[model samples]
Target: MGRSSLLKRIFALNVAAFVLAGLVLAFTPATVSAEIARLEAAVLVLVLAATAAIDFLLLRRALAPLRRLSGLMETVEPLHPGQRLPEEDSSPEEIRRLAVAFNGMLARLEEERRRSVERSLGAQEAERLRVAQELHDGIGQSLTALMLQIDRAARRVPQENPLQGELCGAREAARTLLGEVREVATRLRPEALDDLGLANALEALCARVGDQSGIPVRLSVDPGLPPLSPEAELVVFRIAQEALSNTLRHADASAAELTLAVGDDGTVTLRAADDGRGLGDSVPGAGIQGMHERALLLGGTCQLRTLPAGGTEVALRLRTAEVVA
Candidate 1:
C-alpha cells in the first residue's frame, strides 16, 4: 500500500486506542484509574506489533517483481542474444511495462553491437591489405633492385680488392632483408587465404613459423571440412596467427599443435596448445586481448588456460551459420 494509506491506518489505530482508554476510565471508579491506564497501554502495544507485521509482508510482496527481474537479467548472455523478461497480463502492471521497455532496449543494443563489430572487422581487414600491398610493391621491389645493382658492382670490382669483400657483405645483407620483407608481407595478408582456403592457409602459417623459430608446429584439420564465410575465416586465421606468435615468442615452447574441427551442426573449434612454460602468473597482452575480441565479434568464446600437462592452450569456438552444404 502507498505511504498515505499506511499513515491513515496508523491514525485510525491511535484514535481507537484513545476511545478504548476513555471507555475503560468511564466504566471504572477513580480508585482504579492507574490499573485502567496500564490496560490501555497494553492494548496499544499489541496493535503496534500487528501493524508492523502487516507492513513487513506488504513491502516484501511489492518488491518481489524486482527480485524476479534481477534473476532474469542474470541469465541473459550477450553471445546468444534475444533473452528477455516475461511481460504477461498476470504480472504487475508496472513491472510488465518495465520488462517490455527493457526488452526493446536490449534488441536495439544487440543490433547496434553487431553492426559495430562488422564495421570494425571490415576496417581491420582493409588496413591489413593496404599494408601488405605497400610492403610487397614498395619496399620489396626497391630492395630487390638494390641487391641487383650491388651484385653488378661487386662483379666489376677486382677479386683481390679489399672493397670486394665489403660489397659481398652488403649484397648478402640486402638479400636477407628482401626475404624478411616478403615474409612480413605474407604474414600481413596471406594470398593463400583466398586461393587455397582456410585449412591450407593455416598449414602454410604453421610451417613458416616452425621454420623460422626452430620449433615444431603440428597442424591437423578435419578432412572435407566445410568452408566458412570470408569474415569468419579471417577471424579464425588471425586467432591462430596470434596464438602461434605468442607461443613462438614467449612460451619457451619446443613444440606446438594447431587443431581445427568442424562439427556436424556447423560449429567450428580451433585450438592451439604448446609444450612449454605456461602463462606462469603473467598478465595477458595485446595478442590475447585481440584474439578474444575477434572471437566475441563472431558470437564465439576464447578460452586461455594452463594445460594440465604443463603449458598454455588457446581454445576458441564459434557457432557460425555460414557453413557450406
Candidate 2:
C-alpha cells in the first residue's frame, strides 16, 4: 500500500487493539457456565473498559494539541499584526511551543512594521527640511537681493529709457522667485499651522495657492464639522496641499474646489476636485505616496482619481482613533 494507506492501516490497528482489550474481558472464562463465571465476567468487563479508556485518553493527551494547532495555523491571518495564535490553559508542551513560535513571529513582524513606518516618515521629514533649507538659503536669499536691485534699477528707469523693458522683466522675475520660495516653504510646513488654528491656516493656504497659481480655488467648509486634533488637521491640510499642487502642476486646471465637512453621525470627509486635464498613465511620486501613507496611518481611506469630465479629485475619510497632533 502507499504511505498514506499504510498510516491509515496503522491507525485502524491501534483502534482494534483497544476493542480487543475490551473483547478479551467480555468473552473469557468469566462469562461461561460456572456459577463463579458471572462475577468474574463482570470484574473482567470493568478492567477491559478501564484499559480501553486509558489508551484513548493517553493518545488524546498526546495528539489533541497538534490537531488544534494545525487548524490554528490555517486560520492564522498573518497580515493583521493584532491577530495571534491560540493560548490554551491545558495544551501540551508541543502545542504551547507552536503558539509561542507564532506569537514571536507576529511580534517580530510588528516591530519591523513600526520601524518601516518611522523610516518612511523620517525620510519625508528630511525631504521637507531639505526643501525648506533650499528655499530659505538659495531661493529666498537670492530673491531678497534681486528685489533690492530691482528697486534700485526702477529708480533709474526715469533716466534710462532703453532699460525700462529690462527692468520690468527683472522685477517680474524677482517677484516670481519670492513667490516660489514661499510656495516651497509652504509645502514643507505652513507658517500659520503651528501658530494659528487649523481652519484659518487652511483658508490662508487656499487663498495663497489661488493667487499664486492663477487658478481660482474655492473652499467650502460645513459648519457642522468639529475642530479636529492637530495630527488629523495636519494630515488633512497636507493632503489638500498636495492635491492642489497636483492640479496646478499637472491638470493645468483653471479652477479647483475644496470641501471639509462632518456629519452628525460622526463621519468626516475631505474632498478636492479640479476641472483640468485628467489623469494620465504615469507613476506616482514620493509626495503622492507620502500622502497615501499618512491617510493609511490614521486608519483613513484616500482615493485619487480622474473625474468623468476632466481633472482629478481626491477624497479621504479619517477614523476616530486618529489623533490630531
Candidate 3:
C-alpha cells in the first residue's frame, strides 16, 4: 500500500480506539458501583493513555524518514550537478520514491552541465580560428613579403664580403622564422580551407596528418559529392581536423580513415574512424565537445563512439546551407 494509505489507516485505528474507550466508560453500569467503579475508571484511563502513546510512536516511526528527506532536499543545490539526495534504504516507500526522483533530476542536471561546457569550448575554438585566419591573411602575408624584400636587398649587398657571411646567417634565420610562423598559423587555422574548397583542403590535411604523426590516414571522399556552403565546409574541416588530432593524441591506432559524403537533399557528413583505444565517458579533451557544439549549431549532430571492431570513431552530420556569392 502507498504511504499515504498506510497513514490513513493508522488515523482511523486511533479514532476507533478512542471511541471504544468512551463506550466502556459510559455503558458499564454494574462495574461503575462505588469501589469497583474507581478501579474500572483507573483501568480505562490507563488503557486509553497506552493506546494513544502507541499510536503516536507508530506515526513518528513512519514519518521520521520524510523529515530526513526534507533535510537532504534543503541541502541540494540546483546549479550544482554533483549535489544529490542521500540514499535512504531504510526510508519509507514514499521517502524512497522522492529520493529516486531527486537523483533523476540530478542526472539531468549533470547532462545539461556537460552540454554547456561543450558549447563554451566550441566558442573558444571558433575564436582561435578567427584569430588564426586574421594572422594568415594579414600578418603571415606581410612576413612573406618582408622575407622576399630582405633576400633581394641581401643580394644587392656586395658579394664575397665579410658581412656577406653574417647576412647569409641572418637570411637563414629569417627563413626559419617564416616557416615557424606558417606552421603555427596552420596549427591554429588551415589556410587551405579558406583558399581551397572543402575536398582539396581535407586531402592536404590528411596527407600532412599522416606524414607528421606517423599514423597512416586513409581518405575516401565521394566523387559526386556536391559543393557545400562555406560555413558547412568549415564545420567539416574542423571535425576532420579534431578527429585526426584525437587519433594522434589518444588513439593508439596505427591508421585512420576520413570519409565525406553529400546527399541529394543537401546532407553533408564527415567521418573519422581510427583503430585505437577508446576513451570512455571520461574524455578530458575539449576537442570532442567542440565538435559536438559545432554540429549542433549547424542543425546537425556529432557522435563519438568506440568502433565495434576496437577503435574510436567521430562522425559529424549537418544540413548543408545554400551557397552564397
Q: Sort all candidates by TM-score, best to worst.
A: 1, 2, 3
Global CA lDDT computed for model 3: 0.75
**Superposed Cα deviation of residue 309, candidate 1 (Å):** 2.3
Error of 2 at 246 (Å): 5.2
What TM-score fits each model?
0.79, 0.59, 0.56
How close to the true structure is residue 251 of candidate 3, measured as C-alpha lDDT?
Answer: 82
Per-residue lDDT of candidate 1, residues 96-127 (tens digit): 77789989998999889878877987898899
Whose TM-score is higher: candidate 1's or candidate 2's? 1
Best by lDDT: 1
Please provide, for model 3 over 1-325, each residue's C-alpha lDDT reduced to its tens digit, 9 standing for 90 to 100: 4344435656676776677667766775525556566777777668678777777876776677778788888888543345678665655556677889988987876677657755775677688888877777777787778778778877888987677787778777777777777777787877787788887889999998998888889898988777777766777888899899888988888999999977787777788999988766654566776787667556577888887888988878776663221
Candidate 1 segments exceeding 4 Å error: 1-38, 71-90, 158-163, 323-325
lDDT of 2: 0.75
For residue 153, model 2's alpha carbon misses the true position, in angstroms, by: 4.4
After superposing candidate 2, which stretches have Cα over 4 Å from the reference? 1-104, 153-160, 204-218, 222-229, 244-257, 263-268, 272-288, 299-315
TM-score of 2: 0.59
TM-score of 3: 0.56
lDDT of each: 0.82, 0.75, 0.75
Q: Write down the TM-score for model 1.
A: 0.79
Query: What is the model-wide C-alpha lDDT for candidate 1?
Result: 0.82
